[model samples]
Target: MARSEEQFKKIRDQRYEEISNAALKIFARKGFAGTKISDITSSINLSHGLLYHYFKSKEEIYVALITNVLELFSQAVEEAESNNGTPYGKLRWLTELTFKGDFDVALDRHMLLMEAMQADFLSQDTKEQIIDQYTTALKGIGRIIAEGQQTGLFRDGDEMELAAYYISLSQGITLWNAKGLYPIRVSADMVLDPLMKRG
Candidate 1:
């Protein structure tokens, strides 16, 4: 009985992973509005019934993808915070992670999901949840900036404002990179130097 239960759990986990991977590829290639359950099924070689068994609808899968992406980002920030580095180093590391570092390959897909959410396609509750998650993540960055100021590692300024600036800058880079206006090959360190050196 125990063995059977373990096998079932393993199969369930595997199915979920397969579905997520298929969804990532489809959503990245085609925006959320353009992706369909059939697209995911075709990518995964799964039946529509099987896909529906895992996710009630395409929107559910999108929400799950967004949640997973945010969790991965949060984990990166947490790991950077726990590292034994100077405040400036930590900030640099965080900036690099946010901008140039390798994140989940599904990030492009997640960007599409964000656009849909902003268009009011996602429910208000989900929108609020996403905003709260983003706010929490930014607050973590703000705390680091505040620490840097206290330790004389950063210039004197409003930590919240600086945090907001960095957050917006990171998002802008993503958008511009998507539009081919900015190169993804540029290091975040290169971008941060001028901004950090501002008087």
Candidate 2:
């Protein structure tokens, strides 16, 4: 039986996703310096040849993962901006959405971003691109916080600072979630506490 072009395309996309997922986990855990192409392939029980078919090199995979995550982050911010809700409500919704996933997956993604920012092997162009996306997301988040402040819903503070704090809080919670020794479960409300207005 002949596989249709659409079917082939679907398979190709799936393979790319699989490679990305495996690479993301490795890159997050070990950082670029410690991660090897074989590490990603072995983690997924894939052959080096098969993995290489999807990605040319480990650096390519790293760049792809970072680009994909930043793009998703931008999309999420855009969606929140357009969603029917107050700024504070949108922030709450986003916070809940961030944590509403497999703990390890979420943690890996946060850790990946952290490591990527500090990685020195990435080209200057790639670093600048990342900074651009990050700054855009930060500005979008700041706008939301600023809007909330105007509505008397968020506390008075620098919007950009508050937005940075919001992201840091989410990342902190993600890291803490991976610590099995802790019995604490951080909530969206807890993360948003810094921004919420009080009497």
Candidate 3:
């Protein structure tokens, strides 16, 4: 009576995700440099050797968590960009989709992101890769804004600046959401009113 191969694989993947989730919270509070594999291991019931069995090192876990978050962000932006519709529609879609106060932009999910921005200890290569993913997101926002301007749905201006403006707004929502305000769901329209076209 041995476990089937598929059952073993399922159990392995479940433990892998459990480790990743525990690691994310530690990374959020301690920052990557301050967090060790033991810190992650101690927080979960799993033994020390079990964590290492799945991930070779803290760096591997850090990258896995970050890359997963980046993929989610990238997919949302990509969907907005590829939509053959009005720029205003795309802009609205991106804003609503991201700041919905769920996993997509939850402060917990992105706590690593805010900390990483000021993390001077990270390797130059890691920092560049993070910024590169963020920049791709910015470009997607820019396309939506550029379309809005061309269609007279928005005022003409620097698209990147506009892109930054929108992202900053979402960040503000995320920050407030972290404090239990849940502003994104309640005040999204009020928060975004100033930016939308008046006519």
- The model with the greatest lDDT is 2
Q: 43-148 in candidate 1: lDDT tens per residue?
A: 7789999888889989899889888877876777777777788766777887776765444453574465466458467889988887787777777877887887
Which lDDT tens digits does candidate 3 get at residues 37-59? 88888888888888888988887
Provide the clashing-pair count of each candidate structure: 0, 0, 0
Best by TM-score: 2
**Model 2 lDDT tens row, 38-138:** 88878878899988788888889988998998998898887777788899788888887788788898888788887777778988888888889988998
Model 3 misplaced regions, further than 4 Å: 101-105, 181-184
Kindly report which residue stretches of model 1 are placed more than 4 angstroms away from their true locations once superposed: 1-8, 99-110, 175-184, 195-199
Itemize residue pairs with steric clashes in candidate 1.
none
Ranked by lDDT, the better of candidates 2 and 3 is 2
The regions of model 2 sitting more than 4 angstroms off are: none
TM-score of each: 0.79, 0.94, 0.87
Better of 1 and 2 by TM-score: 2
